[model samples]
Target: MLFTDLARSLPATIPFVGPEALERRMGVKFRARLGANESVFGPSPMVLEAMAEAARESWAYGDPEQYELKRAIADHHGIGMENIAIGEGIDGLLGHLVHLAAVPGDRVVTSYGAYPTFNYHVAGHGARLDFVPYRADDHEDPEALAARARDVRPKLLYFANPDNPTGSVHDAATIGRLIDAVPEETILVLDEAYSDLAPDGSLPPISLMRPNLLRFRTFSKAYGMAGVRVAYVVGEPAAIAQFDKVRNHFGVSRMAQAGALAALADQDHLRATIIRIAHAREELAAIARRANMTPLPSATNFVAIDCGGNGDYARTLLAAVLKRGVFIRMPGVEPLDRMIRVSVGTPDDLALFEDALMGAIAEVGRPTAT
Candidate 1:
């Protein structure tokens, strides 16, 4: 077998160990799938119908340009079709962007405990990564990160508003400052996967664009189309055009395009899901409090509950919780690893989490005071 020097140098393992994989390993199916930040509420009725309709036409390839879906997304964001580029998901787009931007030994910057998938892409592309720690309050520090960018001038710098692992967020003004802080040479990859579920005015206006700024949006989160696999990046035409150079031409399927179009067309359904998520987030926080854990303030659909100890204690608790058949997740790094990340789900799903949490605590006991 032959592989590139890069491929041979890298670890054979992948980052994700999904619930199905866990079930196979542990020999028990999870009762609640809350780890992956998927919307248990599911997609809108219209989106389902559109996907079903499109599935019947599966013999034909989807438009390579993703013309109509791109048009709908453009109209939704008040941007031109030229400004958007569609891909399999944010994950796919991240991989392509890394490919476009990085050479061997290029540097990429991101928050220490931010999205692992982005870091994975950067590493896979043979780029060195520089991580800035989250702020004292658990938010990604734009100022510190910008300073790092100014110093390092990495090929790419990533910032996710309503950041993952913590569900912390910054207002539009802060985001604008982040955009401005990027050095001319670096591409700021702004991930807005949770924007639809964020506080009103938390996101900068969609009119915002820059030559070195690429903002990613997805139908996976608020649209509940994770399985459908449609996401897009918005940037100046020149930057967005880079995807066309290397992207899988027909990666976004007909069903995905149709479902995303229907999802966007039904804003009411999206709004209702946001509300449901907000309510569930509160319930998750309350569950943490009842269990004597500290729930971080969240602007996203998921809540991060501080387990009141070090990473080891949190790991033990997470394992006990998993053994209870509740599928949840935690950061793999220190500091942030002390918090277990729980995605918003239906009441019943959260109730299962609550039971799992309480039982896990009973089984594992509280973390020893440090």
Candidate 2:
């Protein structure tokens, strides 16, 4: 085979199977697309206009420097333009970081059952991964991760604030301690993908920069441009420069840049979207309560509702929900997997999910005592 040894050794996999694939497999169109945590509310009007205008200029490749968008982002965060590196999304930037930092056999550390995509990138590079388990409260345990990183001195340590799967978050002080604790040799890959939706005080200051820490934020969430695929990493200028060595210069499209620029300019639209997501999140929690499942406290746009059972019960309920034309997701590993994750959606979308949840419970029934 022409493939490299590293490529050959890695399994063919994606971070998550998208809802389209599920719709095809199940032979039913999802009446409500609540899975995958996409912003069902869509992007701002100005973003649509900007992207539309840029579409006519699509024949030209996006500027490799991405100067305007980077400048806008830097100004927005009160950081210098040198501190930014743009990419397809946080996922793509992460891949570049892994390639830039970790060679074969280098160690990387992340929480078990955190963002699987980061783990996928680590595996692709043939780096060894050491996992620290999530806390009993379902939050990623920063102190535990810090201890492990100190011991292993891994090339990269991945931590997501307002984390995926469980939608849990720690205060800025706790995150600040974790940031300080990371070993000098290790690059702290701080993923703040859901930062726009995060409650006040859940994020550190944008001006905070460390040579070994890179913070990733995206237009995909509150900006409602997931399909546009634009995200950037913020760090000290020297640390951010390394991404240029491995990133595809033109990977972020012209339309994406235009859309994200407009999205950033329109703070009103972003704030309104956040409010809508919060309301939807509350409705989702209420739906969970109506069905007797416990909704985990969330600072992001989704809720992880405890099914009050084991992984098996959650999986069964998820499958039933899918069968009923409502799409949702769950964590794949133990303990965390006992909850179903439903993204914030429209009133009609939540209505579909509520109906589906009740029916799924009726079909699968609840878990009995051991």
Candidate 3:
């Protein structure tokens, strides 16, 4: 076999078991798909129209330079086009970053139970991962991560603003402090996948730049184009250039570029979808409260509801919910595993989840003393 020693040594791990795979395995389709944090409301009408129009030209590959889409993104952020590097998605960009920076046995830093795909990429590139635990309040601890990065002097340090799983966010001031605190030699991989859903003061200014900082954004979340796989990383030109040496120049398809460009142009539709997601998030919190579980404050398009029990109890509840035909998920690692996460959806979709929750609770019952 020609596999690298790294490849042979690593486990066959997938970051997520998508809902479709779950349905096939369980032999039942989900009544409401809320597990993946996808925007059930979907992309704007303009995006659909653009993608459909671009489909006719799909025989030719998308522009390797991604000129028009990159220009639009640059104008949106008031940044130079030279600072942007587009990829299939944030996941693909992260993989490229890891490949560019880490060699076998190099270290990377991230929060425990943060985005697993980043960790998967690090492992695939044969880098060692050093994890800092989340704060007791469930937010990713930037200070702790900074300290760890300083200690390890890692090749990359990963932090997701408006973080996944917990859906907690830090204000711009605090995040700025973390950014400044990162070791000079370490690249701060700022994953802002949910930034569009965050409050006004939650994100630092787009003009903020450092040689060691790279911020990633995607059209998947607030723009409602997850399936399209279009996202980009913004950084100083030198650091951003590293991706070009390694990235698949045409990995982003023509339809994806057209759809994302259209999505960016339709700010009105984006605002409306954000408003809708906010309402649904509130409803989700209300449902959690009704079930006597605690919903964490979220700045993103999902809510994490504490099941008021341990990991086992949460797992049982999640299994019950899935069996009731609603797809949902929980964090895989400890402590954070006490909650089940659900994405924002329409009234009809959430109503299904609400019903599933009640039935699942009825079936599983609450955890009791040993």
In candidate 2, what are the lDDT values of residues 41-117, reduced to their tens digit?
89999999999999999999989999999999989999999999999999999999999999999999999999999
On residues 11-32, what C-alpha lDDT tens digit does candidate 3 reach at each position? 9978999889999999988989
Tell me each candidate's TM-score.
Answer: 0.99, 0.99, 0.99
Name the Cα RMSD for model 3.
0.8
Candidate lDDT values, in order: 0.93, 0.93, 0.95
Q: Compared with the true structure, what per-residue lDDT tens digits does model 1 show for residues 1-370?
A: 5999998998866677989999999988899999999999899999999999999999999999999999999999889999999999999999999999999899999999899899899989999999999988999999999999999999999999979989988999999999998999999999999988888779998888889999999999989999889999999999989899999999999999999999999999998999999999999999999999999999887999999999999999999999999999999897799999999999999999999999999999999999
CA lDDT, candidate 2, residue 125? 93
Best by lDDT: 3
Q: What is the Cα-based TM-score of model 2?
A: 0.99
Clashing pairs in 1: none
In candidate 2, where is summed lDDT lowest over 10 consecutive residues? 361-370
Candidate 3 has a TM-score of 0.99
Give candidate 2 regions above 4 Å deviation.
none
